[model samples]
Target: MDWEPHARRLADTVLRRRESRWWNVLASTPRHVFVPAWWEHGTSGPVARNGPDDPAAWLKTAYQDTTLITRMGTRHADHTTPGTLLPSGPWPTSSSTLPTLLVTMYRHAMLGPDSHTLVTTGTGYGTALACRRLRDPSLVTSIDIDPYLVTAATERLDAIGLHPRTAACDITTNLPGEFDRIVSTVSVRPLPASWLHGLRPGGRLVTTIAGTGLLLVADKADDGTANGYITADQASFMRTRHGDDYDTASPPPSVWDAADGDGDTVTTSRYPLLDVQNTWDIRSMLELQAPGIEHRFHRSTDGPRTAWMAHPDGSWARAAAPDRRTSPLVHQGGPRRLWDTLETIRDRLNRTGQLPVHGAQATITPDGQTTLRRGRWSATL
Candidate 1:
C-alpha cells in the first residue's frame, strides 16, 4: 500500500498551526515502519493490532497525530499476536510519542546543522526525525534502558537507511557520551546528575519533570549547574525506568479503601469536587505542593462524583459531592491534609488566576538538586 501520501498528510496536520523546518522530515519519514503493530487501550482491555494484516487501518492510525502504545508491562505489541486482548491493569511502558509533541521538544532543543544530539529511543521514530533534521546520523545518539527496545530500534533505523549510535543504559545513572543537546522523551525527578555530567558546557537539555507536566529547558553552565525556566507548554511522559518495568509504588488497596471510608476529620469542602488528573496546571501545582500523591476520580451514571487522594506517607483525602456544582463533603486522615492543600492551591488559582509552576525559574545544581522559584514562592526536589 502507498504510505507516502498518508505520511505527507500527517506532516501537514502536525505542522499546520506553524511553519517549521521539520516539515520535510516529517513528510518523508514512514512512521508506519517504526510502528508496525501497537496496543490500544479500550473499555474492555488492551487490544493488539498487527499492521501487516490490515494495511489500510495501519496507515490511517499510524499517520494520525496520536501516541501509539508499543509496549505495556513488558509485552510489546510487535511480539503479541493480532487481536490479542490482555487483562487490564498494566500501564503503557513505551510508545511512539505523538508527532506534534515530538516537534515541540525538538524545536525546544534548537538543533543546529552540526549539533550533537542525544535522544531517547522509544520507537526510533523521534531519533529518525532528529537524524533527518541534523542530516548526519553520526551526530545523533539514541539510548534506552530496555535492551530489546535498543536492539529493535537500531534494526528499524538501519532498515530505513539511517544509522545512529544506539545503546542500552539507564539514563539516570550514566550517559554514553557528551553532546550539545540532550532531548529525553521520558520524565525524570530531581534531574539526573549523570545528565549534568554528560552535558557539555553550554549544552541544552530538554525534558519534563516526573509527576508533573512541566517542560524544563535548561542550558549547562560553566559551574556544572543549569538554569532555565519551565516552559508554558505542558507535557507528560513515562518516568525513567532502570529495569524491565516501572516500579510498583502505587498506594496499596487498603490505603485507597481508607480514603474511601470515613476520615479522621470530615468537613464540607469550600469548592466543588475537581478531578486533579483532568487539569494539568492544578495537578502540577498539587504535585509540587504535596509530592507523591496518587489521585483517583470516579463518577457514576447519576450526578454524584467522588475524588480520592492518597500519599505514601499514610495521608489520604476523599471528597464526594452530589453533583458537579455542589460543594463536596471532604474527609481527611493521617498527618497531612491532602484535600486542604489542593483546595489552597485552587483558592490561590481562583484569586490570582494563575499558578507559579508555569514559566517558573528553575535552577539545577551539579548534584541534580532542582529548585524552582517564582517571585516569593519556591520549591525544591
Candidate 2:
C-alpha cells in the first residue's frame, strides 16, 4: 500500500507550519519501514502488532504523530509474534519517538548546512530524518549501546538508500568522534562529560534530564565550559543505559509495606492527595529537590484513594483520602520527611506562580558538574 499520503499528513500536523525546515524531510521519510512492528500496552499486558499482517493498521499507526514502542524490556517487537501477550512490568527501553519531539530537539540544535551530527539510532528513523535534512548521509553518525539495535537500524537505513556511520557504544562514555551537533533521544543525568569533550568548539548538544521533562540545550565554550538554559518546552526520554537493560533500582519491599503503618510523625495534609506521577511540574520540582523518589497511587472504585512515595534511603510516605475533595491523612518515616518536602514544593508553587527549575539557567564544567540557577535558587546535579 502507498504510504506517502499518510506521511504527508503527518508532516503537516507535526510540523504544523509549512515553513518549518523539517517539514519536507519528515514528509518524505517512510516511518513504517523503520517501525514494521511494535508493542502496545494493553490492559492485560503488552500486545504485539506485525505490520506485514495488517497493512491498513500499520499505515494508520505509523503516520500518526505518536510514539511507537519498539522495545519493551529487552524484547524488540520485531522479534515477537503477532497476538503474543507478554507480562508487563518492564518499561519501554526504546521507541520510534514521536515526530514532533524529534523535530523539537533538532530545532534546538539549529543544524547548519554542513553540520556533522551525532544522533541516537533508535529505529534509525531520526537518523534518516537527519540525513534527509542534511542532504548528506556521510555527515551523520548514529549510536546505540545495543548491538542488535545498531545492526537492525543500519540495515533499515540502508534499505532506503541512506547510509551513515552507525556505532554500538554507550554514549555516556567516550564518544566515537567530534561533531558540530549532538542530539540525543535518550535522557541522561548530570550531562555526560564525554559528550562535552567530544564536541567541537562552539558545538551544541540537545538532550533531556533523566528523571524530569527538562529539555536542555547547551553550547561548548573555548574554556571547556558550557552554558545554556532549560527550554520551556517539556520532554522526557528513556534514560541512557550501558547494558542490555536498565539496572533495577527500587526501595526495599519492606519500606513499601511499612508506608501505611503509623509513622514517626502523622498529621493531616494541607492539600488533597495528589498523584505526583501525573503532575509534571510538581513531579519535576520534587525530583529536583530530592532525587530518586518513586511514586505509587491507588484509587478504589468506591472513591477512597491512596498515594505512596518511597525512596531508596528508607524514607517513605503514605497518604489516604476518602475522596478527592478531602485532605488526606498522612504518615511518614525514615531519615527525612518525604511528604513534607513535596508539600513545601507544592506550597511554593501555590504561593508563587512557578518553580525555578523551569527555564532555569544551566552551567556545566569540563568534567560534567552541572549547576542550574534562577535568581536566588540554585541546584547542582
Candidate 3:
C-alpha cells in the first residue's frame, strides 16, 4: 500500500527522543497489516474506507496514524472485504488509535522485558507492538470484547512470527491472569478492582479512568491500594461497549436551559485555538478531576469560534468569540463556570510551564476514587 515511507516518518517525528522502550515498539511494528479496512464517519453515516469502491483518499486515511471509525449504526466495517463498500453511519463504534498517543500510553505502562502484560486488543496494532517488544508470547495476553477481532489479531500477529495468548474476554470483568503490567486502550469510568486483584505486588497498571480523565499509571501496593502519577498527556478512545454497544446516556434537560442564560461572565481567553483535545497537561488533569464533562468546539469557515462544555450533572458552558485571538464570551450555569475552571488550570500551567500531572501522587481507594495531589492542589477523579 506504499505506507512504509509514511510509517517511517511517523516514527522519526513522533517516537524519536521518546522513551527507548516505546520508541522501539513503534519502530519495530508494521501497522498496516493489522488494519486492512476501516470505517469513516460522514454527514450521513459511517462509510467503509477500504475495498474496490473505496477511494485512494480513503485508503490513505485508513493507513495513517489517525483514528478511523470502523463501525457505527448497526453495521461493522471490518466485515467488509476488499471489494465492497459499506455506507457510513451515525457514530464511531471502533477505531485504530493515534500512533503517537498509543506509544505515549505505552511509555507510561512501564512494561519491561520480563513483565507480563495484559492489553485490550482492537485492530491488533497495539498487540502486535507489544509482541515485538516483549518477544515472549507467554508474557503477553491480549483480550478484546469481540471474538472476530481476537481471531483477526491472532492471525495477523502470527504472520509476523509473533504470538500472544489471545482471548475474547471483557476486561471490565475478571482478567485471565495476574500480570506485572496492565494497559487498556479502552476507557472505563471507574478503575476496575479486578485490575488490582490481578496484579502482583509492585506491578504497574496504566489506563484511562473512565468518565473524565487521561492515562493513569500506578504501582500495586502492599495494602492493595496502588499509587502512581497521571501521565503528562491526554487521549480518549471509544468507551468500552457491551451487548449492542453504547446506548446514549440520558441527557440532562437543564443543560440547554443553562445555555440560554445571560447571567454568566463574558471575557476573552489568553490562548487561541484552545486545542484542548490536544493539550496533554490540561486534558490529563481535567480528565482525572472532572471526567464527566464532554467538550465541543466549533469554528466557522469565516473564523468565528464557539466552544461548549457539558456535564451529565446539568452543568454547562458556552463560549463564543469572533476570532481565535479574541477572548471568548462565556456563559456558564448550574454548579460552576466550566471555562473558568479550565482557564484557572491554564493559568497554573502558565506560571509553572506545566501542570504536575506527571509526578503527582495518586492514591486509588477501594471505592475507585483516584486522588492526585501535587503541591497545594489536590483533586479526585
Q: Residue 81 in model 3: shift from native, Å?
A: 8.1
Estimated TM-score for each candidate: 0.97, 0.97, 0.80
Cα lDDT, model 2, residue 366: 94
Model 1 clash number:
0
lDDT of 2 by residue, 109-160 (tens): 9999899999999999999999999999999999999998899999999999
Candidate 1, position 328, lDDT: 92
Q: Candidate 1, after superposition: displacement of residue 217 in Å?
A: 0.3
For model 3, residues 2-81, the per-residue Cα lDDT tens digits are 65665566667676765555665666676767776776555654456563354455445644667765556445676665
Q: What would you estimate as the lDDT of candidate 3?
A: 0.73
Error of 1 at 254 (Å): 0.9
Q: What is the TM-score of candidate 2?
A: 0.97
- Relative to the true structure, candidate 2 has a C-alpha RMSD (angstroms) of 1.3
- 337-358, model 1: which lDDT tens digit per residue? 9988998998999999998999
Q: How big is the positional error of residue 322 in model 3, measured in Å on the Cα after superposition?
A: 2.9
- Positional deviation of residue 376's Cα in model 2 after best superposition, in angstroms: 0.4
Candidate 1 wrong stretches, greater than 4 Å = 17-19
RMSD of each: 1.3, 1.3, 4.1
